[model samples]
Target chain A: MSNLEQKPFNVREIREEFPALRQQVYGKNLIYFDNGATSQKPKLVLDAINLFYSKENANIHRGVHYLSQRATTDYEAARQRIQRYLGARKSEEIIFTKGTTDSINLVAFSFGSTLSAGDEILISAMEHHSNIVPWQMLCERQGCVLKVVPINQRGELIMDEFDQLLSKKTKLVSITHISNTLGTINPVKEIIQKAHAVGAKVLIDGAQSIQHMHINVKELDCDFYVFSSHKVFGPTGIGVLYGKEDILYRMPPYQGGGDMIARVTFERTTYNELPFKFEAGTPHIAGGICLGKAFEFLETIDMEAAERHERELAKYAEDMLDTFEGLQIIGEAKNKTSVVSFSVKGIHPFDIGTLLDKQGIAVRTGHHCTQPLMDFYGIPGTVRASFAFYNTKQEIDTFVEAVERSLSMLK
Target chain B: MNLIEKQEEIIQEFEVFDDWMEKYEYIIDLGKDLPKITETNKTEDRLIEGCQSRVWLDSNFRDGKMHFTADSDAIITKGIIGLLIRVLDGEEPKSIATADLFFISKIGLQEHLSPTRANGLLGMVKRLKLEAIKHISAS
Candidate 1:
């Protein structure tokens, strides 16, 4: 009542808010367990997307017309919403791009442009391909060495190894806040402190963490944070890159066209200010508004309760699956999120995933775009059943039962 | 039986399953029955690309017939691979190259028919046809 907060954390009530969950696949109710890859959109965000297209569809920031002004207001307001959501210093700190991969590439190119030959960029072994490849490309271009912090069998980053890797020569330390495949929550706060000590800036890939936890860039003191709108219950093709205002001012424009310019001429060009310096072209205007609506939707939830429920789901699934003789849970970090990734001794994850899909219990299979992590475990892939707050234990029961049946058929 | 007859046989076999689980279980059994490619034959050159599961298909032409042996890491994929080989194997090279795989859809397995499906059935079929063309040109 006080602030339009969503009713207290009730899974049943919250489930009603998402319309996608009420569908059937193969005559069975769909049990979507792919939150790590992307979350299902809520009705509020869906309506916002439709409303923008139906009524407020116009190119933003340039036109003085009523429609453009309304679109610009909503878009800028969305930027501010993201800023407030992340506890970023100003709306100027939030720049929208085409999802997390684009966000990482922006930092890699712009911030990477600042680095010189022989300077090092440190990342962990568990990062998604987006985080790894961008830096690798940067290292190739700039002649900067890319060092990876190794992880234990439990899939946790070896902090001591990271400490050894972080030195004066290290220019940046980019790591994931949570492993999308393993659900291991990295100690990004400590990593930020250590990186700052060694005078290296840090970027936390919050593509997986933002939806599951509370993030305050000011408190975390990270140089940059990136996430995708689709992974946070918003529309696809849009994401955020939250960088410190000071750092963003120093970096050059990523793409040099359209909105990202201050003034353009035949002779010379000047880049735009803060966020606009990075955002080029029209951008996904509808996605921006809907993502803002998503953050507003997120405001209503009790994240702590939601997090606890998700953790319980993971634990409950893990315990149940462990009973099977050859099933091995991949990421067993003490501090993990609601992701249960497991491999059976003789079964390929693709087989399990295929059968699960036939039964309408959706899960992810294969390398999950982290082939190196898969190689670390000496397995091709694992069947990953990642959970969101809306998922319940009963669904877990069906999934476990389906796994058992699938195993029986495979065997 | 000819290629079309074999495909029709598969469709008829699948028609009796009232639910998907029973159908997939039958596929799993067929996968188990498929003669696996030799470890040496499962070389890099034999592996099909664009499949989520590793699929190694070995082809040979003898007695004017195109023979195919396949293996997959996943049982379900192997089952589907078995179904493909069932339709395409033991046929003349010309017939193998021109065969219509309409039964894949008829068997309620339309999901695997797309060129975009990561299981690479379409890719495997393409490879099988290419092998057939090679044999046909040689003759």
Candidate 2:
């Protein structure tokens, strides 16, 4: 029963699970290094999608019909699956959302109402726009102060600065577990403990970390955790917001609609309980069910070994790319993940990205939804090649060569 | 040469380059020949912001003809701009606005027309047509 994968983590066999990997683009084998944006779904998740639409297509809850009951059962089962996956104590803590952005917006609108003027919400410099913009909107509405924790040149959060920023006035600390652009693995456990000492709730954006490693919310003991299913090889438009039971109960309902209401009356209406109170509209039933299947696919793999493989890929890529004369790796964090982002001295990232695309390497070249981080680095954007466990060292070799060729062309 | 003759000439030139690499090398050369707008004209107002690259377009209406001088931070995008300006410039506003731009596809560079393309050739084409429309409506 040890999923330590004693068989030594066969990536070739693992790559077979994803049909997308067995494809050609631009007359060459496709090299997908854009896992930071979204991951390709395994056949298990894909089949679940087909099964849901073909047979299990029905609106969940409130329906006494056979299909509706079946759908409701499947949908609730998915929530429980996610709850157990995150090591959440109760299923009531899991709230299905549109994605990570929607989950953050939900907390911003519902829990944000609890804060008054001059209350501070602390966030880090490397947070995606999804994490930053919602809190900014919350601040704008409530006159709350937005305090930013700065990062070092290496893209690691300055713990000293974070310590100085955390205070009684700080109501919340929302930070990313991993930077999407820089691949910096933030120390969220330390952050959570520090934030809690000052009576501040911490929301860890797990959009980057969930698929890469084993996440136990009970162990982390954070107030809230949010991630997109799409980034975790699940269906798009469905995500999970894991909040502490007590905190979720204290926050008001996000949207008033069918599923979220316990009772509806023009004169007086009562809201639903726990997780249902936050889930307002008719949910993406297929997406919810298929995401559970995505979790099932993940369970079959040894995530620890996979994480090791990804880290090795990052190291190999970084070491190879560092040799170029004018090329500078954007983030040099000691503890990082699978992303290797770099900028050439004079060449624009866009031009390099274009040539790479023609060579059948799918890379992301832009600010990567971290404009403030880009501003801090004093660069317009970077060419980011993010790796997954299925990616081989051979592919990195090809990718490095492509980068070299592209840089030569651009220069 | 008229717009049609010039497009045929460019298409013929691209036809010789059998491979994408050769085509790109030629385009990179073409980028060097792009009629660049001066730094003063490269203001925020002239910027056509793309998802990846930045483009600046300078439009002038002279003698009933539409003249465009544009620049892009990315050389590939600049070369594409060069191609657009080659056929459209010196043509009347009405002709330029309605000109069927078939050469981009004929030259096997239609991928740039995709909205997802970082160079934002689709946006450039739209801005170019928009420039033409401005002069057409004025008259």
Interface DockQ per candidate: 0.76, 0.69
User: Candidate 1 residues A130-216, lDDT tens each?
Assistant: 999999999999999999999999999999999998999999999999999999999999999999998999999999999998899
Off by over 4 Å in 1: A1-3
Tens digit of lDDT per residue, candidate 2, span A1-411?
Answer: 112223457899889989998898878899999999999999988988998889988898889999999999988888888888899999999999999999999889989999999999999999999999999999999999999999999999999999999999999999999999999999999999989998999999999999899999999999999999999999999999999999999999988888999888889989999889998889889999988888877877888999999999999999999999899999889899999999998888988888898888999999999999999999989999998889999999999999888777777
What lDDT score goes with residue A177 in model 2? 97
Clashing pairs in 2: none
Off by over 4 Å in 2: A1-8, B118-120
Q: Distance (Å) between predicted and true CA of B78, model 2?
A: 0.7
Docking class of 1: medium
lDDT of 1 at A389: 92
Q: What TM-score is obtained by chain A of candidate 2?
A: 0.98
Write down the lDDT of every candidate, Cα atoms only: 0.91, 0.90
